[model samples]
Target: MSANHLEQLREAVVKMNVDEAEAIAKEAMSDGIAAMIMLKEAMIPAMEAVGELFGEGEYFLPEMLGAVDAYNKCFALLEPDLKQGEFEPKGTVMLGTVESDIHDIGKKILAALLQGNGFEVIDLGTNVPSETFVKKAEEHSPQVIGLSALLSTTMSEMKKVVELFEESGIRDRFRIIVGGAPVTQQFADSIGADGYGDEAQTGVELVSRFVAAP
Candidate 1:
């Protein structure tokens, strides 16, 4: 029964059937299955498969966008169950588009991917200031903070976020990850970011790795 439900869940996500996916998530919750088990066994793997298809050009932006929306809908349905059930979060993550940058498509995808993979995500919406990021980090104490900047002019704010962490003497408290257009491995290194993801899936993979390690 559980296996069948999981199978259906994966198909729903792959097909970008938001209603179907949300129904299945609610159904699993009613059946007393833990939220994390449903996610790890079905939803997360489904998104990974979607990512693979996208990477191979078998899926395009519109399809990927639909799939991501479906995934988020399913997660929204399961969120209450996740909080009320015995599921353990992989790790907490803080995410946002840095100050002076308003773009969010990639960052939003990364947030969904992280949440689907069992990470607790604190999403600070686009154009977040460095001071806000640091304060939130101190408040949430997450394992990682992801910064996004879609423009070269705005990219410097990512470094300022890191500097605020340093000034607060909490630089070691969390891992800093940077991404979005105009961001690169070298730019990440230059900004003193702990990691860089050229794309959303890579960002998800990096966060997964960081959370899985002791």
Candidate 2:
């Protein structure tokens, strides 16, 4: 497919026009486009644009939320129609906001970005306990586990969660990614996390690089 069609899909997603988004998605599929290609080339760019706009103050939370909703709706329509062997995920990611942190907007944005980029995300939602994160990781066996904590106080919870995984003997099984307002690369290093991102887009990029590495 030409880059123009991909750009059109991105624009539709930015506009939060569900009908237009669905039409473009169906068209892409009908044109024999690869699902992963569509996700990586079109949908992810669209959501990333929305995030950029939000960061630049050209868009607000409501618009960002709407765009994410539209993108997810389009994805739902296209997912079941994808050929069984044609959809190869970049990786599997389990994501959640750590215990005592009720702030979820950042976590939700990260989830959307990850899913839009072809990672199969298992979102565990807000205020997730450290034990629960370890338990879920054991059950799902994802390639990466993402923890978010917007509050400084809750950041310690990420360390405890890492400890839980270590105690479970599965610490080496998954790459540990930590993020949110209070999280820093130094903090991540101190806690023995594999990666740290200060923002949602950075998190997405970090995960992509981690999964793509040899």
Candidate 3:
């Protein structure tokens, strides 16, 4: 419950100390600090800071992956408590890495942050085909669908997914967003995607806006 504990937890996450982060989360839970508080105050902010550093080129993929791992460790400890608490999810989000793109660090980070921000996330993992996205969207009816592609070669798969959704007459049923290392806002626009996230934090914000829209 003490502010110092929160600060330590935050530092542990930012420093990519996975074991220490999980230990601190457990300690906070034992002290009745609440899962949501640790999430909103320490863990989320730590990842946001990591995102900022990544944007500034002070951090690289390995650093970001480490931070995500640390965050995941802490989140795993708190997730059950978060689910049991009095919380209503803001919306449902379905995420996956587009076909041929086996990379999923960005998608994983986005999924964790979405869950922390009170969105129910269905992460479909890497190498997801266009038809699979449409199939899952139909099955889940999520508010937002996020496509990720780390390689420029796989970026076209995102457009294919969007086109298939449109062809299925369900494109308008959900907000479609795209992102990854090689994805740009212009690319998203050209693919008819509703939005583009340059990073994990931006992805969460974009999804938030889509779900909050009238």
lDDT of 3 by residue, 18-116 (tens): 988888888888998987778778987898788889999998999988998898888778767755622598999999999888876558767877877
List, residue by residue over 70-157, the lDDT tens digit for candidate 2: 8878777655543243257888889999998887756766776677677888999999999899889889988889999978999999
Candidate order (TM-score): 3, 2, 1
By lDDT, the better pick of 2 and 3 is: 3
Top model number, TM-score = 3
Off by over 4 Å in 3: 1-75, 78-86
- What stretches of model 1 exceed 4 Å from their correct place? 1-86
Q: For candidate 2, what is the lDDT?
A: 0.83
The global C-alpha lDDT for each of the candidates, from Candidate 1 onward, is 0.84, 0.83, 0.87
| Candidate 1 lDDT for residue 36 | 66
RMSD of 1: 6.1
lDDT against true structure, model 3:
0.87
Per-prediction tally of clashes: 0, 0, 0
Candidate 1 accuracy as lDDT: 0.84
